[model samples]
Every structure is written in structure tokens, then in C-alpha cells.
Target chain A: MTISQAGSYPSSKGIKISTVDTKEVLCGTALIKRGFAHMQKHGVIMDVTNVEQAQIAEDAGAVAVMVLDKLPYDVRHAGGVARTASVKVIQSILDSVSIPIMAKCRIGHSSEASILEEIGVDMVDESEVLSPADENRHIWKWNYTTPFVNGAKNLGEALRRIEEGAAMIRTKGEPGTGDVSQAVAHIRMVNNEIKKIKGIYDNNDDQELIRISREIQSSFEIVKETGKLGRLPVVNFAAGGISTPADAALLMKLGCDGIFVGSGIFKAEDPLERAKAVVIATTYFDDPKTVLEAQKMIDEKKSMLGLDTKNLDLKMQERGPTI
Target chain B: MNNELLIGVLGLQGDIEENIKATTNALKEMNLKGKVLSVRYPEEIMKIDGLIIPGGESTVMGLLIAIKNGLLDAITKILQEGLPVMGTCAGMIVLAKKSYDKIVGNKRQLLLGVLDIEVERNSFGRQYDSFESKLNISGIGNDYKGIFIRAPTVISVGPQVEILSKFDEKIVAVKQENIIGTSFHPELSGDYRMHRLFIQLVTNWKDANKGHQNF
Candidate 1:
């Protein structure tokens, strides 16, 4: 671990810092937040609606399960107000599963996040899939003890979310669509932007760095940090619209730290088999043979009917603040 | 000890890279020669001088091991043959001889049962309840920040095990011969003292086992 002076900035947001011996140990700081996200690396986090589905996900070797009221597909189909999962259901799933249980809250909904935190949900996704509570501004996540994960389509959005204290990042591909193209594009875009910043940092072009930071609407420190790290400050997982084991593997191969299946698993013909296969594929993403074995475990005909991202009336990826 | 040692971090899931980086840094700080590898397949367990089971979901780690044929057996056999191993948090639970949920009955999960201890899962509550504390660990000096994230606690231990540290009168760390288990993650703590100690254990074990056939 490269122990950077993460919370060294003089901000009133209360970045807690504690020193142990000569070593500067960060507690309730960036390390704790990023460390929590790091635990989910190279694994699969499945989305499930209820206790039974959560149990099946646990049984399928998922690192964690995301608990939500409705599958993203159903949420889109219903065309009504989408909200957080029920307290009763979340508690029951928490009791039933040994792995971490993550729940989604509407973008900028701090009260829902507080309730989830009180209920002891492991992590909160300030997800765009849910109707945005306040589209103009996101919650100041640094105020809360619980870590929040936000979605981004490109580098500026990712840094903005990270600046707001999101411990993790996921590409906000069109949710409810089984398509992986938008996710692929989003990750590539983020990677290219990172590469551009890294070039500026490497050249020691202070003026250019400032210009780029302004363009991204993030502080010079965070943009510089992202350049130095050559990646997002937190774990970046590929989410939204992943349905198959191959899709999971592709994301892993494309530099995603992990995989998230939203509407993909439950909507599949064989949820258990598909869930297990995706997990396997993700763990052994670098190995073609194992990926092939995982591919054989699921039937292509049983996959969800994917939506075309080009024709979506509701684009979750575009919901959050652009700058 | 050999000129260059090879250490493996069990890479089925969870914080594998963090452990690898920490181990590499520990090796460099001690001015020792070693390489850290992420060991995913069961057969790779035999090639490492030592092993580290990182923090993740114990249920997922155990289940993944059980899914792959001979993985559990492979790890258990090598650990018994005295390959120094350190398990942190979820890793600690996986190494325990027995495990139970704090709120409910015994958990039906795959544990290697190498460490002669009983661990209570989620004894520190959920992620929100997770915290960091300074500990006076034996031999490593004091004020080492111990980060517990949805961590577990050792409920009981056998005679062979030595308690290393504790918090609120509960066991948080243990050492038994070649095995070391901590309910908190040393890799995430930013203090490499614990990793250094584990590396020292690995060096000692390698020196003692010289040309043993199992190694």
C-alpha cells in the first residue's frame, strides 16, 4: 500500500486523521472508505430484490448482494416512482445472508441514506437508476459515516463523485438494458481521460493541469491525485446492464475492478446458474479456459431481452450533474 | 533462508492486491529478498514460502474454495506442513477450527480449521459499526492502528495459541506456531510491523525446514 497523505487537506468536512507511532494512520478517512471498496475487488456483487434471491446470490459465491425494491428492469417497466428497498425486507436479507448487503438510495437522497445507515446496510449506492431526488446537486457524502458509491460515465463525473466522498465508482450505463456497449464505452472514456491527465502531470505542465481541473469541475488536488494514481482514487466496478458471464469477464478484462449485475441475474431464465457462472467468470477473468467453462454453465437462449441504449427514453447515466 | 523467498496471497476473492503490495513493501523494508504472488489455483499453494488470506467475506472465500476441487484440502495440507500463514478478518475466520454468527447459530461454511480457535462472525456489528483503534501488540510495540471492517472476534482458543492483542476485552489477534490470525486487517492499517513480523515468521519457518520434502 502506498500510504499517501490522503486527508491532509485543510477542509471543514472533518477528514479525521490519527497517527500511530511514526506512521500516519488514517481512520474514518480515505483509507477506510477506499479499503472497504477494495474488499470487493475481483469479485461479483449481484443485485437481488428479496431474502430468497439474496440467499441464492450468497450461495453462488457473490462477494456481496445489492438489495433493492424492484429489479432495474421492473423499475423501468413500471414507470412509477422508484425508491429504496423496504426496511423490513432489507433487515430480513441482512439477517439471512452472511456476505455484505448493499442497498440503493435515490441520487441526492440523504435521508434515505441515513435510514439505510441506521438499518446497518453495509454500503449505499447513490444510484442514478432511482429517480433523482435533487438532480442539480448531490448529497455531501463526507458528512456521513457510511461510505457511498456513485456512478459516472467519464472522468470528470468520476472525480466529481469522488470529491463528494464516494468511496467507489461504477459506470452508469443504461440500467434495465442487458446491453454492455454503453458500459464498455463509459469505462473506455474514463480510461482515456485518465491517460490524458497523466500525460499532463508527467510533463509537469502546471498551467495545463489547472486548465484540465477546471474543465473537470474538480479541485486541482483531486485531479492531480487521480493523475498520480493513474486510476480513480477508489475501486471502479462495471455496473448497469450486465447479464451474462461473458459480459462480466469483458468488464474485468476492460480494467473494471469488479462486476455488478443489476437486472441481469433475476431476470434470466436460470438465476442461480447465471449468477454462479458470472461469479466464476469474474474471478478467473484472465483465463480463457475458465471463462469458457463459465460460459457453458449458462444458456444463451435464457438471457434477458436486452434494450437498445440508443433508443432509451430514460438514460440513468445522464441523470447526475454533468460538471 | 533462501536468497529469494516466494510468498503467496490466496486470491480467490477479497483484497488480494492489497495483501500482495503490503507483503512486497514489508520484504523491501526488512531488506529481505522475496516476491509476492496471488495464488488462485489449488496447485499453486505448494510453491509458496508463506501464505496470506486477505480480508473479504469469509462465506464467499470458503464457498469459492469448496467449489474448486481439492482447494480446501490443498490449503489445509500445506498449512499443516508448517507453511507460515497469516489470516486477517475474514481470513481469520476461514482459518479457524470453528465459526458461529454472533446473532444466530453456527455458520455452515467451509473453514480450513487450521487454527485451533472458535471465531464469532460480525461480533463488531456491520460496516457502520466498524472502527479503528490503537493496540499494544506484543513485540511490535504500541499504537498500531487496527482497522476492523465488519470484523470478527475470536471467541475461544486452544492451548497452543497465544493471544496477541485485544479490544474491549475481546480477542482480536492470535498466534499459534507458524500460523497468525488477526480479526483486524494489518494490510489496511498503514503500519507494516505486523507484515514484517509475519515475514519474520516465514523466514524462521523456512530456516527450520531447510530442505524438507514438503517444502
Candidate 2:
């Protein structure tokens, strides 16, 4: 049925019409960019390589999928320059799935980010998992309309990325290892620092706050805002080595707004079951019984053979700029 | 506890915190005694006077809720029994009886199927085409910021649904009695008028259903 025929109101007859001015319809504003990331909060974002993988992620209830040329584990094994996923594959995945599709660009690679944005990818990740394109600088994210999710090891990198217009932040845990230790450490470190800043702000110690701001290399205002909010200004997710339902739940319990699973699901013996299990664990992070049920959904023997962060030759988390 | 309103933002996925914050602020501004929670469990879903399904991927939300065993049924039953609910953006897609993508075509996901509307997902195109506008939300008033982010537009509604707001003559907001659905995200906006209106609906629903409280 048509609007006027089915509904009670007859096509704008009794509707309170404004002057019918063409209100400026603005896109890619900061609110729009940041707001897009907010919609992904409390959800699992999985890494998918092809159309089939993308569809699997969608079937498993991933809020979004991040497309990559190779999963991080395979990237580590390949040990070469990993660029964005092929245009054909990305396009196919985008066309195939109704959920938001994200693609990761090399650190400091503007052209790659621009290309992905041009293809209408929902979000871009200026990720360190891919080989670094620049040694000294990360891409200035504010230059583009496409929202970016940057990884951070501590509070400094997070606020710096936010200052550079990164709409979302995730901990740069040791990628490809499948070990949750580094991810746990990074989020805990970020949370501990936020606690410290909140304490300084609560004490009305502007001097200490400014000193801490300089130390972290974040803007004083953003630092103060972080302190006031007692969390990152934007959504913070845990990424890199998340591999199990318990791993996902632990990060959520540690205050990650959501999760980004890379090599976690696909590398497991039962990708579908593991993916579904992780989504459930993340959704009910605070509930132990549900988490336990999720944990049992997958066999421990089927999990990816994890590497220790200390033994890795190429540490991806150390790729981005220290300052 | 009896007089206080307990509102919930469906926590399966997407913008749960934003809705919680918006509802909390609306409660404070209106000086109402209420508690807003991020709810996921069926038991939790049964205890609320009102619920908000936040913006995210509607496919993911529907799948997650359905997998939770009886969660979708609980939400549908509550809405049918006069529990006030507001769905925004992808949330609006979940509330609709039918939804299809403008490009990829028909989807096969679980839906609450409570709101009597057919929604066209990504009707304004992809994320790159997402935009913001000033709309006259009939009940909430004018110049309301309508942030449409890869949003849906209601193609048509049944006679029971009341069209509340429109942009470019497309249905962006509709109310089917205790249930309200919007194509734009009110939680993302700085304005709390829409949320205030939702809380008002919740308050009135609670008053009318007095001894019939599900909790």
C-alpha cells in the first residue's frame, strides 16, 4: 500500500509543513564520522578476506567486517608488504554483505585510505598490522571524510589519534600471535592511565594534568576530557590477538567497548562456531554462565596455536610513531 | 521501585551506550525517577517499562537476539502487550515487519515484526551518502537534527502507524501506539527532545498498564 492510502494521514495534507527550505545536508562531518563508530560499539568486528568470509562473518552476527588482503597470522607468515585487499574482492564483499564493511590501510598511507573511501567502504582502519608505509608519520585522518579506527598501545597514542581525527580507537595488541596477554596489557594500561588522569583532574591539579598531557603527547583539552569522562572520548575496542570466547569476554570486562577479531575466527578449527561463540561472549561479558556456555561452544584443542608476544621477530604494535 | 520507570536499551549490539546516555539525560531533564540499563537477557527484557533498539547492523542485531533463545519472543510479546519501545536507525529496521536492501535485495534475518511498516535499507545510499538534515518532527517540533547514517526509510505503513516526521516527504519517523521507530539516530544528536518524548510514552504506558506490569 502507498503512504497516503494505507496510513491514517493523507499525503502531507494535515502535516505541519515548514518553509520547505533545502536544509544543508552535510555528510562526513565529525559527528557523522564519530557517530558511525558509536554504532559499532558493544559489537564484534571480524576480519574477512573474501566474499565467502564476509558472508560468514555476516551470518555469525558480526556488527561489521574489516577486509584485508590476508589475515594477520598469514601476513606474519608472508613477511612482506601487505597492502589493502584487492579492489575486486573488496567490491564483491561490499556488494555481498548488508553489514558495514571496513578495510585496513597501511600506516601513513593516504592514497590507500582515499581509494577505500572512494569505493564507499563504511570505515577505514589505518592499521599497523599491515607493513608500515611511513616510518615517521601516520596519515592525518582529518583530511578524509571516511571514519578511521587507529590502534594504540597506551593512552597517548589513542588521544593523539583522536586529535588527528581518528573516530575510533583499539589497542595495538601483538597481532598474529593469538595471545591475549598483549591485548589485555594494552587496555589495562590505557585504563590505568585514564584513572591516573582522572585522579589528577579530581585533585584540581592543572599543573600535573598539563605535565601528564605533555608526557603523553596528547592535547591538554582532550586529556582533560578523557579525565572528565573517565574513558576515551571515542569508542575503544580491543584488537590484534583476540582468539577465543573467553579472550573476547575478558577484554570486554576490562572496559573495551567492543572487539576486533583478526585471525581469531578463521584460524580456528570451527570458524563458524568460534565466531558465533565470541559474539555471544562479548554480548554477555558480565554474565559468567553465558560466557561459560560460549566458552564450551568451541573445543579448546581446535583453537589456533598461539605465539608468545616476546618471541615474535616483527612486533606490529611497535610500527606506528612512538610520539 | 514500583513508581520508578525502568528503561532498557537493547544491548545485543550497536550504540547501547549512546542510547543509555540519552535516556539518562532525558530522565534528568524531565525530572523523572527512572533507571536506564543495557539489557540483553530475556529476563532483563521482561522487566523494563520501555526499550530502545540502538543503531547498528540490523542483521547482526536480529541474528544475535534470535540466537539468545526466547529473547526475540520476549521483546515481541512485551511490545504487543503495550511496552513502549523506540527503535532508531538500524533499530528501526529490526522493528519493521519487512525490510529489504535497496541494492542487494531481500534479506533473511530475524525481525521482531512489531511495527507495521516496510523499510528500505540504505534508501539514501551507502555510508558515503549518509547525511544530516533539519526536519520537522511533528510531535517533537522543528529544526531537529536528523542524522541519517546509511539509514532506512519506511516505504509504507499500516493504518495503525502514525507518521511523526518526514524528510523530503519520506517517512523518517513513525509511531504505532506504544512503539516508535525512526530512520535517524536521536542518540547521536545533542538534542534529547525525541528521547524525552519516548520517556513520556513510557510513563504514560506504565500509568495505563498499572497492575499489569510484566516485571
TM-score for the A-chain in each candidate structure: 0.94, 0.93
Ten contiguous residues with the weakest lDDT in model 2 chain B: B206-215
Which one is best on DockQ?
2
For each candidate, what's the DockQ? 0.46, 0.47
What stretches of model 1 exceed 4 Å from their correct place? Answer: A1-27, B211-215
Candidate 1 Cα deviation (angstroms), residue A243: 0.9
lDDT of 2 by residue, A1-323 (tens): 00001101122211212333667777666667777888888899999999998988889989899999999999999987899889999999878888888999999888999999999899999999898888888987767767788999999999888877788999999987899899999999999999999999898898999999999997788888788778887889999899999999999999999999999899889999999999999989999999999999999899999888898889999886676
Local error of candidate 2 at residue B63 (angstroms): 1.4
- Candidate 2 docking: what grade? acceptable
Worst 10 residues of 2 chain A by lDDT: A1-10
Evaluate residue A88 in candidate 1 and report its C-alpha lDDT on the 0 to 100 scale. Answer: 98
